[model samples]
Target: MSGLRDLTKTKGDRLAYTATSSSTVNRRKRSFILSGLVALFILVAWLSGYMIDPSHLSTHLELRNLPPSLVHPFGTDWLGRDMFSRTSKGLGLSIQVGLLASACSCFIAAALGLAAALGRTADAVVSWLIDLFLSVPHLVSLILISFVFGGGMKGIIIGIAFTHWPSLARIIRAEVMQLRSAEYVLISRKLGKSRWWVASRHIFPHLLPQLLVGLLLLFPHAILHEAAVTFIGLGLSPHQPAIGIILSESMRYLSTGMWWLAFFPGICLLLVVRSFDTVGEHLRILLDPRRSQE
Candidate 1:
């Protein structure tokens, strides 16, 4: 009778544990869904504001430097331009640059990584190049590259795209190399299938997840670097309504007690970058099978 009671208690404990674990998982899933929806809403709102009208951000001397109020939610800058409008436009432009640069960088990494995995000679050369690029400070390299290209939107895009690929390329090359040595790849080779054909049909599909994750991770870096270069006067033109330009212009007026000029725009930039980082982290967690178990 005691043995029977002990067995029943053990079974009850197991059921309780299972219920608790399931509840925890349900809560986490709900949290993830809520986070995703909020991020999407913020993105859509910003995009709508960006596409609304350029005239909205135009200078209005009379409205200039107005403090935050119902009339101007983010207040007005020294030039009397709507701070909210300027911030949205500037952030939108930064997103454009980040998307372009991140895409280009990913393409470069994928191409070089595939090339390296295709041959030993190519692998050695690519490895050396990766090392060379990594040896230099990214900012210094970005500055030199941007300055050489005349320091504007074009320069910033090209500079960021070229400088950001090395680490990703290394990761991709290692993954490809491992895949190349797998049994199926070996069998495909033995069956008279060309390396290019196998890689295109098999390897590329496997690479998509990694490539996507890398692209998302690269976005925040690209945006931040673009702003940094612009702030240091080696990036986009001041005439452009970029976050860097807005922040740079705000510096001169900060001492005059127009703290909103810098504070609002800077905070907005940080929020956008952080949002991208969060999305990327969540994406990685979702896509990784081992992490999904956790």
Candidate 2:
């Protein structure tokens, strides 16, 4: 009787484990599908904006200040420019800037993070720099940096790249520190393998997922900051039709009751930002072992 009871318990445990595994697999599939859909949406938006002709955005005084309609989906701006075109172009530009900035920041983070693993002194210096950057507000630091660089696409990208790396750097540093103690790494060290060889061969492959997620997560922040600085006259040129410039210019006409001027563009920016954020979060969950099971 006792043997039969044990057999039943083992079967129950197996069933439970199978159910959990199934659930995890389903969750991962859903996450992957959602991420793919959001990514496709972003790609479409970027391409539409990138490919639009300048002539389509030319001012039409007769169509100025129109509200959202079937023909003008997002409506017309005060300058008679199609807000849809302007928003799309602005979002595309923002995405491009965000990509560059995030990639640059990731490079910085990876370099400093790997360097931190070299020695106690290197770790301390990297930690201090991380803390120093974190101590200040991002927007404030970004503005100062942009101003220093004379505030253009170049300034904005450089400013964002410099400001965004500390958080990701800290993550990479912690990951490397933990990885350093792993049995494989320790054994490689004992086998007369150089530190650089071990890091290149064993460590970097593990860091790639974290780096990719970090890049996606940093993108939204970069876009928002770029828009903010530009809105206040410190980012892109006024003639550039950037979202910031759109919002800033819209302010003057808001009291006159043209809501779509700022409304559509602002909403579009938020949508793009949230889409990237969602993709990053889903990728992070998929990549993380502990969270993947949940």
Candidate 3:
């Protein structure tokens, strides 16, 4: 009778284990599919930036602004340059702006947030300064800063970096506050670990999971805002190859029935932003220590 009871228990455990494994596998498979699509989109955008071999086209008005067809896949623009090439180059610049601005934001948010969480003294000082910066509308603030700093790519980078750090800073401050209360921190204190040592070894690692997510999420926003500032003629120089330049230039050609100038670049911008969000979000979920696949 005891042997029979053990056998029944074994079978129930196996069945439960099998169900859990199946569910975990299904979730991982779905995540991979979504991550792949986003990765492919980013790869294409990266390639578009410099996949050009200047060895291909030459100066010619004869082929200018040709419609999309077999010879030119994405059509041509007013300058007789291949729309495909210009798009790839324009996307490259936007990618540069996104990444550079994001790096600046990550560092700024981490330092200030961590500082604020160190104690009430540090928190009060940092909190007051962050709130002051957060009070104004971001776009207005960006333009105002640009007007001061010569209103070019440099201005755009600086302005975006300034305005975008606050959200992540606030989130990081909250995360740090929670982490400071965790038992491990108290244990480290009991063990005689220096405050800075404890923060580096214990607190920062826990904060990273959310910080990574915020950085990627901020990327798409940075790209869009950069393009907007550029479009208004207060950001990057008009002559530079940029999606905003292409879009702004298209307005003049609209009455003449040339819409491809705006349409193709717009699609590229949207897809790139979507991929950043999806892949960044999925990666964050995977990296989260407390998040379980099942």
Candidate 4:
């Protein structure tokens, strides 16, 4: 939004910070480590699910409320379901929702953002609509939309995409507007390149790194939000295993000694959220040229 912005113009420390953020630089090592950890969890959860039928059901009322021990690593719930298996499976479900929802949101963001950047009447309408959506809390918007759409995977995807795209669209619009006049972009147009050609080749490519960083940040939010909705009984069906559902069911037994029922699943959720945030922060730094320079 600032007039004729230049990446090089910065306070000393700011420039240093930017330099440190260059995505293509030294931090690849740390980024890889963080990413690998997430991948490992996903792989383990996925493979474990196929090998074991979590629906077999456990029946041990006496051992049901036991603490974490060798036989039941994460302990047992009220129904005697293995917290380890349920928690692991729940993670898979959570990540699935997060991945699908975030992908949909990012796609919507890109499309709407490009539309807004075109500077047309349609762009104005989209701007106003996006603003209206943004005015409400994202969680509330998602909840309302999900309820309207009939609470399930379809609803979750639609709700998340609809609620979250506004911010990304606005950010991308600003970026596109800035890039539209950049040296590379202008040069492409001056050479008689098609509008689409210039935007696609010069403008969009420039936005990719930052967009990726933003997406990584968005993933955790989507996952956690989905879990929250489920916890409140508005998300996934109770028949299916999910982190929220597991915890929500566990609430009835909290006073009992079976603390591990909620404990382990909660830990799994925490790790996944933290992992996403860690990667997102690192990506934000790496993608910003100024940070890289810093």
Which candidate has the top score in lDDT?
2
Q: After superposition, how far is residue 194 of candidate 1 from its true place, in Å?
A: 1.8
Ranking by lDDT: 2, 1, 3, 4
In candidate 4, what are the lDDT values of residues 172-279, reduced to their tens digit?
888877887788777877889877777677777777876787787788889989999999999889987889999999888888666777888898889878877877
lDDT of each: 0.87, 0.92, 0.83, 0.78
lDDT of 1 by residue, 232-280 (tens): 8899988888899999988998898888888888998898888877777
Worst 10 residues of 3 by lDDT: 51-60
- Name model 4 segments beyond 4 Å from true: 1-28, 42-47, 55-63, 190-192
Residue 213's lDDT in candidate 1: 84
TM-score order of candidates, top first: 2, 1, 3, 4
| Better model by TM-score: candidate 1 vs candidate 3 | 1
Per-residue accuracy of model 2 over 1-294 as CA lDDT, tens digit each: 999999999999999999999999999999999999999999998888888879769989999878999989989987788888898998888888889999999999998988876778989999999999999999999999988998899999999999999999999999999999999999999999988888888988999999999999999999999999999999988888788999999999999998988998899999999999999999999999999987
Looking at candidate 1, the ten consecutive residues that score lowest on lDDT are 41-50
Q: Each candidate's TM vs. the true structure?
A: 0.91, 0.95, 0.89, 0.84
Error of 4 at 248 (Å): 0.5
Worst 10 residues of 2 by lDDT: 111-120
For model 3, residues 152-191, the per-residue Cα lDDT tens digits are 7888888888888998999898888888889989999899
Best-performing candidate as measured by TM-score? 2
